[model samples]
Target: MGTTPLTPGLAPSPGSDGTGVVEMYAGDRASQALGIVVEDFGEDWARCSMTVGPDMANGHGITHGGYLFLFADTTFAMACNTEGSVTVASGGDITFLRPSHVGDALTAEGRAVATTGRSGVYDITVRRGDEVIAVYRGRSRTLPARPAPPAAG
Candidate 1:
């Protein structure tokens, strides 16, 4: 953490339209706390954006790798969970191509590469406008649907 927290004005917060995305983001304190917004999404893809805050900067004065990974991962989560099943990352990897700074608006877009037998592979690209900042590839596992609780009388 650097100089700022999730203050006001990081408007149009995550997922205000899609039901699954909305629900997922609604319970996602991490993404919300970072002020990520869901720009658009479809069956196997999602696009999100966030502006880097001072709190996300690293000792080198650029945005931290963890924050970049988190942004990409959040977009991946949105893409993989659009089918209405709870999915979680089994593992993921990211490569930083360029550095982003505080106040830099970044966009993370993810798309499913493959899926089979409850496992999925997704690739996420993080960009500062037209510049590619990072690329993330994630493996996910979709959990079995939980049984509903007992109905009330």
Candidate 2:
């Protein structure tokens, strides 16, 4: 899981149907439970949003760091998986710069910074309005192809 420079000219293009990238994120239940919504994504970029409700706040009445990380991680996942490959985060780091209170609507934007072979690096910024609240960096690796889920009953 060492950091590798993103290979040039290797960034995948948007899916042919345009909606395939979005469909990949629709199956994420944990993000949904946290009120995360995928706003837009294409190629190596993704944008997602979440509202800071009571349940997301810590004892100090500010949004928990874990929640912020989760939001950014979800955005990173969407950005890296746009190519239709099953990707997983190998590791990530986040820096908190500001506090978010209840009712604040936070948006995370992620972009692929580098990629080589089966590994990639992404950077995500969490913002409230125009103010940046946190910055996140994630490393991802594409996994071996697995069988798709069985058709819905």
Tell me each candidate's RMSD, in Å, in order: 5.0, 9.0
lDDT of 2 by residue, 1-153 (tens): 121112222333454232434566557777767777777677878888888879888999999999999999998988888767778899999999999999998999999899999999999999999999999999999998888899999
User: What C-alpha lDDT does candidate 1 achieve relative to the native structure?
Assistant: 0.84
lDDT score of residue 21 within candidate 1? 67
Error of 2 at 23 (Å): 3.6
lDDT minimum window of 10 residues, candidate 1: 1-10
Q: For candidate 2, list the clashing residue pairs, or say none.
A: 6-114, 6-115
Model 2 RMSD, rounded to 1 decimal: 9.0
* TM-scores of the models, in the order given: 0.85, 0.82
Clashes of each: 1, 2
Give one digit per residue, the lDDT tens place, for model 1 in 37-148.
7777777788888999999999999999999999999999988877667889999999999999999999988988999999999999999989998999999999998999
